[model samples]
Target: MLLTRTNPVIKPRTLTSIHEQLRDHGVNLFHTQMHEREAFKAMFSFGGTLETLDRAQVNNIDKAILNARDFASEVVDILKAAQNAEGEGAHLAATSAPMTSSKVA
Candidate 1:
């Protein structure tokens, strides 16, 4: 229903205009440090996890890891909310059902 995040990078100059256009359409964008960072790519290119990566080679490695943790936490919260809503919907449907009977000989 809404656009939350964007691709690898939207460019500094174009971000403002894009954000404004999306907002006019009732769409919100979530900007996170983990969205586009060199540290993330370095982890893959160097063949190692965030912790195992060499801080000297990758700038802002620590910040990138922290952002990743935060992003993951946000995802978990969203999933939990969706699950709760689904359960409530199911409960309502079950309670609103009509009773039916069949005759047998």
Candidate 2:
């Protein structure tokens, strides 16, 4: 199986696919960055150094990692946007909306 991380945009399905690639690596980088990430490291089944996995798989995982990074970028954007939307005046802090309109006018 090959995973490509080239595209920055993602559909939810792609997130699901990336989750699948985690196999034992956990859902995202929060668990995969090191040898003992609580979620992914222990479950990682590969027996040797990263060199042991097929080149294509490694590259694919790299791409998937890129995808995850992109996802984090999107989340930051969403959070900032949400925070901005909740702000009204200089003094008031961001407040949760009871309901948010889809079309900003």
Candidate 3:
């Protein structure tokens, strides 16, 4: 999983190079929204989950929620694919119900 890391000030080119290297090694990389970190920081400061946060005060909140949903879907897909690869898809089915912002703190 990859979260935004701004501290230490690494160049974008370097970051992309590292990401490419990791992908070449068959590493699964999950990238959250660029401003998702800010949204989480707001959640901590305001003492509430994403659903409880005021949309008017947060920027790109809708995108953040969509990003979360996409990430969750990708994870479930990977799990199901792995299960099928191991011949356990019939015995152990991986499933996920739709999630609300309140459920994704």
TM-score of each: 0.72, 0.33, 0.61
Tell me the deviation in Å of residue 9 in model 1: 14
State in Å the error of residue 82, model 1.
0.8
lDDT of 1 by residue, 1-105 (tens): 223333444546576687688779987445443456677888779988988888889888887787788877877877899999999999999999897677786
Regions of model 3 farther than 4 Å from truth: 1-11, 31-37, 88-105
Q: Whole-model lDDT for model 3 versus the true structure?
A: 0.66
Compared with the true structure, all predictions reach lDDT values of 0.72, 0.47, 0.66
Candidate 1 wrong stretches, greater than 4 Å: 1-14, 31-35, 102-105
For residues 51-72, what per-residue lDDT tens digits would candidate 3 score against the true structure?
A: 7789888766666666667767
Best by lDDT: 1
Ranking by TM-score: 1, 3, 2
Clashing pairs in 1: none
The better-scoring model by TM-score among 2 and 3 is 3
Q: Model 3 shows how many backbone clashes? A: 0
Q: What is the lDDT of residue 54 in candidate 2?
A: 53
Error of 1 at 21 (Å): 2.3
